[model samples]
Every structure is written in structure tokens, then in C-alpha cells.
Target: MPRFTVFMGLLAMTDDFVILVVDDNANNRFALRVLLSRLPETEVIEAAAGEEALMHTVTRDIHLILLDIQMPGMDGFETARHLLMTERTRNIPIIFLTAVFKAKEFIERGFAIGAVDYLTKPLEDNLLLSRVRFYQVLHARENRLADVVRQLRRQERSLSIALSQAEAANRTKSIFLANMSHELRTPLNAIIGFSEVVARSATIGPEDRKNLEIIYRSGNHLLALINEILDFSKIEAGRVEVVDEATDLGLLLDEVIKLLLPRAEQAGLTLLAQVETIPAVVRVDATKLRQVLLNLLGNAIKFTRQGSVVLEVRGDPATEGAVRIEFAVRDTGIGIALADQRRIFEPFTQIVTHAIGAGTGLGLAITQRYLSMMGAELTVESTLGEGSVFRFTLVAQLATEAVEVPASKGAVIGLAEADRGKRILIVDDDPDARRLLVQILAPLGFALAEAVDGMDAIARTASFCPQLILMDWRMPELDGLAAMQQIRAEQGEKAPPILMCTANVLGEQRSEAIAAGSSGFLVKPVRRDELFAALEEQLGLCFQRESTEQQKAAAVVISPTDLVAEIATLSDEIRDALRKAAEELNTSEVGALLARVADDHPHLARHIAAMLEEFQFEELIALLHA
Candidate 1:
């Protein structure tokens, strides 16, 4: 509601009181004025009729109204009712003066019309003076009360305006922080992505490779700091979101350890993790839980210079598959002082230690905040000389399905690489991000197309018809959400899978991309393997970067007898359908046939898809005969 100002008209007076005397007869008005003047410090306002009396109330301050009962146009009773109706004149006491109406009924009627007192024609001058004085005293009290009320309302309106401005400023700050997150993360993604690609180059010399590794690590650390700021802002604003799904907790721990192992080794710290003997699969927010563990483990490893950093997970199972799991990280480096434990959790609070890595102090604070949202807390125990231990517990329900954790990719023996020239689109406003994506995918023998922003992505998508798209979430003209919606609406079935990449890993953004029909959402800086994994999953591309074109050509060649012998392990019924589909050149049906055992036999799926795309029906003889 908008603020409102109300001007109230109540009887106001100084030491000298002003009275309104209304009468049609000039003689009666004179008599009432002369009689009212008997009261000390008094001034009489004369009105010939009720309308004139109302005008006097509006123009001048009238303490009390002395209305004559016998009037030509508006009588005294009617005039008293009018005086009681208006806010300006309502609070003024009315005294009716008349020679008649002394009967019980007329006297009651006079008081019923809001008259404070009534007097007959032969009124005593002394009594009239005392009544007017009593009314003036009562009017003074009402004015004082109304003054206080008006003051309170003014203060209330001021507070309301200030509160509105504060809320608006907070909203503006939130928008700035959100935009700042996007602006910083866009280029940070490119830096981390490109540095990692260079670090993994086999052709680089030892010294150069070492420098590249340093660059890669530094970029990653920078990305982490940026993430910490964004996360802290979200948490502070109460916008943190948690998404729960079925995940293998054991594998999650292993991946975190794998990620930190290199850094731990570089620092000469022994890093190890152990998952207790319990059910591996559980329903939880795997992303948040992994983040918590990563922070704790990374901190433990970073702070431990010469000694070991160990991560341990233990599950205390209960009835109905409910388990209380405790995750702890222990280190043997320089321990924190007891007084500093609390301060270290505050943002930007750096511990004085001999460790090399300098981290944004938000890691522990964010971890604790995340845990608190999940109904948990972080507990720490540290001595002055020895290392420290940090732990937390979470409740989870065990998953019924057996978890099939993927083993390491291992050596690519006999892994036939897919045909080259698979077109992939990279969409971002930042040129560095686009160039970095090209660097990551070009060596894998894929054709690359670039779009500057969301608007550019929409314009080029239909014609380029890329098999995959890595779209940045924040863009200038059109954001990822709007562009994705438009592309899906226009292209429908032909729109290629879009994997949105953003620096923000908030669940709301993830949910938005999913709602907009995005195929995947990846937070930057994206890892090289994870990026390829998404491509392989979405496009069914077999990644064997070392496989030459000469080898792929030789593998698809066919001979009638040799082909039948090659797939002798195949069943008869599936064999007939494969040959029929290959003959009719139904690529989708061929893909469906290949899907039957693709999970178990990715090599055969890649082989069959390749032959089907090449239209080499002779090669299908072996697939059919299998």
C-alpha cells in the first residue's frame, strides 16, 4: 500500500476560546454572543445558518458550536446532526439554545442529536458560561490525542519508505552478484580447460610439461576460489539448493581421491581413502556430498606437507536399510591451535601454517553450511603439534539395486575408432572458451563449429546441424534458456542435443536447463574426460583417439564366408533381423538392434553402427551371422 497523509480537523484553540453561534434571528445571535462573552477569554463566531456555521469551522478554529433551535432553513437539531457528520467539526461539542423543547421527549431528542447540553430561552448567564468552559477543556484533550496519533502515523510512513528502499537495494545487489558470477566464470572456464589440455600433451618436454602442470593447477585453484565466492553468496542469500539422486557413495569418494592424489603427491603428502564395508549405493544429493568431501579432503591434503592424509567412511547400518554414515578426513601436518578452529571457518580467515597452498577460507565454511542444510555439522579435533581430524555424519537409505561401478577405461586394445568428421558446435560469448573447446576436441578428429552467443547459436544450429552442442548458460543477446526454448520449438526433432555449461553449479540453474529440454548440464571448468564422456553418451561416439583411418577402413571390409565365421557366436533370430535391416538401410532400426547388448558390448555397437553408416552390407553378414 502506498503511504497516505490524512489531515484531520479537530477543535483547536489557544487561551482565548472561539465559539460558533448559529441563529436565523440577529437578535438571538447577539443575545447568545453576549451571554457566551460572559465567559472569560472568549470570542463568538456568528453564523446566520447551518451552512455558514460549517464554513466558519472550515475557515477558522471553533472550540464549541452554540446552535439556535428555531431556524428558517436548517433547524438546530438538523444543524447539530450535520456538525457531527464532518471530521473537521465532528469533535466540536454542540449546545442547543431554545425557548421550547423543555418537555421530556424534546429534551431527549436534543441530546440524541449530538448536543452536549441544552438550555431553555430564559437561560442563566452564569450557567452558560460554565458549560462553555467545560466544553473547551474537553476539546483541548481531543486535540492533544489527535496530535500524538498524527505524529505516530508520520513516523510509520517514514519507516515504510526506508524499508522499501532497503529491499530494493538488496535486490539490486543480488542481481550484481549473479552477473558477477557469470562474468568471472566464463573466462575462468577457458583458462582451466585450455591449461589442462596443454598439461596432458605428450609432446611437451619435461621442463615445459612441469610448467604446464603448474599452470593447470593454478587455473584450477582460481576456479575453486571463484566457486567459493559464488557458493558463499548463494548460501548467504538462502538460495542454496540440494538435489538428491541415487549415487554410489564409494565411487564418489574414489573420484575425489583420484582428483586430489596428484596434488598430494606434488606436496609429498600420502593421500588415501577407504570406504567401509557396506552398501555402496544410496539416495542423497551426491553433488553436495561430494563437494563437502572434496573440501575436507583437499584441505587435509593441502595442510599436510610431510605426513599422510587419510579419508575414511564408515556406515552404521540399522533396520529397514537406514544407515548413519560418518565421513572423516585425518591429516598429520601442522595442527591448528584450539582457539583458531572457530575463526578458520569464517570466510577469508587464513591459518598460519607451513603449508604451501593458499585457499579462500570459505571451503570449510561452505562445507559446514552445506552440511547444516542436510541436517549435519562438521566437528574438528586438533592438537598444537600433531595433525587434525574433521568429520560429519549423514543419514541415507540404502539402494536396492546392485551398483555397477565402472572400472578404469584401461588400455584400448583392439578398440576400433569411429569415423571422423563428427561436427560439434561450441556456443559461448567468450572467445577464449570457444577456442579452448576447439583445442580439447580437435585432436580427437572431430569437426568444430563456433557461435558467438545464443543468438548466433540459433542462427547457425539448423544449417550446421551439429551432432553435439556445448552451450554457455550466460550470453549477451539471448541467454541459454531462451535460446534453448526457441531452438527446440523451431527445430523440434532435428535439434541436436545441447549440453549447457555454466560456472554456476546451483541446482536451480540445473533444473532450469532440464526444464528447457537440455540434454545435459555441466559446470565449468569442465574436466576433459567428463566432457568426452558426455559426448560418448549422447552421440554414441567411440573415443579411440589413437586409432588411424587405415585401421577403421580395414575393419569394416567383408567377405561372405569369412564374415559368417567372424560372427558365429550370434543367435539365429537376432541374426535375421540384423541382415534384413542392413539390407533395407534402416539406420535407426540398426541402432535399435545394436542397443540390445550395447551396454555389455560397446565395441560391437560401435562396429555395427560404423558399418551401417558406411552402407557396407557385407560387413553386416558377420553381425547377422553372429
Candidate 2:
């Protein structure tokens, strides 16, 4: 009997296919081996008994097995049962070949015992070859498929390892950025804070006041740059969120123009603002909007050497209560090339031809992202060697309530009599930072204590029992979070309100500090007013502000005649040096020159100082010549 009849074309065989021949007589085994050898790359193993066949199946990688129905000790049927019982040789295909057991019941039993085919004593060679070839090709295909599966598993493992490494590297980069921001902002806290403190002194002459103003403004500019970098980092981390509030668009625009006017004047460029019409108050993210305008106007001033930079704003009614405001910043400078226009919006990208001044190249990129977050797109128009206009429109609902002009929190002279004796503990590792807090609070008549680090602050908290604590985030002895946790655990609800004043400006860092029981979070270079507001909130204290009359008296300007007379009193050499310093716009040199005049002619120096404070350089120069 034969199972496979149709003969396809002769197929090529691989060397991997191995066949086992099991029989009672050696002659039958030899005949099967000869027939299997006809196939290319096929290996045949001869087993005289079923026992030998089982041993071969275990030791060798057998693909196909030929079994005899009866043997002396272990027959083919019993051997097949044993093979099926073991896990190792269960999948090997078996064929039953028998001479005596050719009866119908015996054949049926052979087929039922897991034999792939039951052949009679007189075997057909062609049919046997076709069947053997079929199994050989099938086994070869299985082996190839198995090889592919193994290769795929190896590739998957490699990708998993690579992905893990990439994630680890990104984490490292984020940590490095956090540390860098903290380190940079810590010292800036003192720089900006101390400048403001000194500038507020009533006794300081107008010349000294002007110099301090420069220091304060420059510190703020540097702080803004630091913030820009941090903002980009936040954008990359997908943590930036827009915080909308009622904003006086007109007032904000005025303030931005005033801030950047000095730069434009220095560059001999005109800065103009044209507002056709706009809502008095609109709901929007004031901080981001201000930043966008600053970046655009600043870049315009930097690039244009002689021409004017214009900030034109137009508004139109959109929906029932919303206004679509189109703000455009146009400059007369070297414009961006058509090829580089789109590239300019990419982070840290600078056009070669338009790189006229110092910048991080992040201004426009940040501006674009900020606009995108506000549901707007920043578009640009430019002509090479002419100028460029960057414009964007935002739709904001009109805030119906009148924008309240907050009364100036004029120079905080001192705390009210009730809060004068309240105890305050300042905790920081940096001496300057502690000194800054002392400078701000000690003058207000608060009983202040200073601690070097978190551990020292915890000790002071018990001994001094301060009413309020200003804690720094990073310290040598113990980190702020861990130390704050310990204090909260020990003191529980009795703990004094602890404000975490740190240089870590990240939103997540602030969240962590608050989660650890911080009363409030303050990012540094903390403004004096901001620090005072935070204290007032925590301590429920009122501050004594400078009176209206005192503020007015401090702001009074010197008469032109008095200024001219003061300039005349200076020595010929001093007058020339003063004129030269004012002409060069060297603020420090002018301040030094004014000190010389203050020594002998105090009244005249004060008058000339007023002129310097107002940036009346041309007037001062003419008075010097007179």
C-alpha cells in the first residue's frame, strides 16, 4: 500500500534532513536505507530493532522514522507508544512497515498507533520515495521558519536594550539642566535684590541712583535670558502651560516699549508704537505675551542700525465677546532670506546674514511656541537687504471689569508697629542669599535669625522658635525636601509657615516642595515686592509704605538754569571729562565724574545728577559747553 501517488518534479534536499530505519531483519533495514539515500543531502540511520531506533531518536536529530510492526523484544507499535510518551522524540513522523501483520485489524491498529502510513510487505519504491521527499521538504521548511523566529527574538532583545539606554540618557540630560538653572539663578537673586535695595535709599544722589538703575535693569535682562532657557527646557519636557489672567493690553505695551526704548536710542534707531484700537482689558497669558513682544522688539532694535522699529497693533471684533488682535513687529534691517525664513523658527537657529548681535537664537523660537500654545501662528514676511515683519493674531475674550490700577506699593520703609517684633528665620547655604533676606527684612524691624543650612534651621526652629522660616532648596547638610519633611513630622500643625525660596524654577520642583509641606514657593532672583507680599500673606502683617508727599518730593526734577550753573562750577578738565563720558553714554564714568563735583559743589552736583538720571545727555553736554 502507498500513501503518496502524485510525483512532482524532483526537488533539491538540504544536508540537515536525517531519517531512521527500524526493522527486525537487517535486510529490510538495508533496503530502506538504500532507497532514502537516493534523495540529495539525505542521511539514513539503520536500526536493527525498535530499541535501537528509540536510542537513535534520542541521540540523533531524526527527521523521519521507518518502523517494522513486529520485533523480538520491543515491537514497532510498542516502540511508537514509547516515542509518543517522551517529550524529546514525540514530534518525529513514523511509518509502519510489516510483512506478517498485513491483516485489516492489524493495519487499522498500526494506523491508530500514530503511524503516518501503514505499508504492506511488498512495498512500492516510487511511492515511498515521494512520501520521504515530501516529509524531507516539509521538515526543511520548518527548520527555516524556526531559524527566522530565533533571529527575530534576538533583534527584539537588542531593540529593548537600546531603548532603555536612550531613556537613561534623556534622564541624565534633564537632571543636568535642572542643576545648571539652580546654580545660575542663586547668585542672580542677590545681584537683582541688592541693586533694588540700594537704589531705594533716599540719601543716595541722583548719579548713584541712575547707576544702580542700570545694574537693576541689566540684572533683570540676565534673569530674563535665564528664564528663556528654562522655558525652552519646559517646552521640551511638555510641562509648559498657559496661565491666563485679565491683562491691560495698552499698559503692557507701554511698559514694554519704555523698557526697550533705551536700547533703540543707543542704536540711533526710532522705536514707535501704533495702536489703532484695542480692548481695554483682555483675558490672556500676560507674561508670555510680554515675552513675545520683548523678543520681537529687542531683535528689531538689535538688527536695525539707523532706521526705526515699529510695533503696530490692530484689533477687530470676532465673536460676540471675543476680539481678534493682530500684533506685528516690523523692522528696517537686514531681512531674512527666503531659504532661511522657515528655518528661523527652529530652536537655536540663526541666519548667517542676519546674525548682527548677541543672542541665544531662542527668542523667535520661543515666541513661535508661545503663540502656538495661545492658539495662534506666527507668520513672517521679509525681503533680503530690506527688513522683516513677524506677525501673529490672538483671539481673546474681552474682560468686562475695569482693569484696576494697583496703587504703587512704594518703598517699603518698615513693617507696621504690630509686626515689628515678629521673629523670622532665614535658612540658606549661600551667605549672600542670607544677607539679602536680612537686608530686606532686618530694616523693617523684624527680629531675624540666620541659619547656614537646613539642619541648622531645624535647630534654630526649636531654640529661636521663629514665627516664619525662609528655606533654601539645596544645602550641604540636608536637602530642603528631606529637612522640611522632618520638621513637618515633628511640629505637625504647629509648624510655622515655611516658604521655600529656591532657584529651582521648574514647575515639578515647585510641586514637590509644596507636596513636602511648603507654605509657599518663591523662585529667585526674588523681587523685593514679591518677598514682602509672600511675608504679608503668611504672617498677616501690614507694611508701612512711603507717603505720597515723600514720593513726590523724591521724584522732583532739577531746573535747567540750576543744572547749567552747576555745570559751570566744575573745573575745565572735569567739565571736559564729564562731557566726554556723557557723549560716550558711559554711565559709570559719568557717575565717577559727578562724585568729583559733589565734593566741592554739592548743590550743583545734585542738579547735574538730575539731568543724568533723566538721560538728558544732549542738554548736559550743551550746559557743559556754556
For model 1 the TM-score comes to 0.59
Each prediction's RMSD over C-alphas, in Å, is: 19.2, 9.3
Spell out the clash pairs found in candidate 1. 570-626
**C-alpha RMSD between model 1 and the true structure:** 19.2
Q: Please, what's the RMSD in Å of model 2?
A: 9.3
Candidate 2 lDDT, tens digit per residue, 429-507?
9999999889888888999999998789889998999999999999997977777888888898898999999998888
By TM-score, the best candidate is 2
Best by lDDT: 2
Segments in model 1 whose C-alpha atoms lie over 4 Å from true places? 1-84, 87-190, 246-283, 305-328, 353-357, 391-419, 427-432, 451-463, 472-490, 501-518, 542-626
Residue-by-residue lDDT tens digits, candidate 1, 125-199: 878878888887776777688899999999899999997996788677677776776777677777677767776
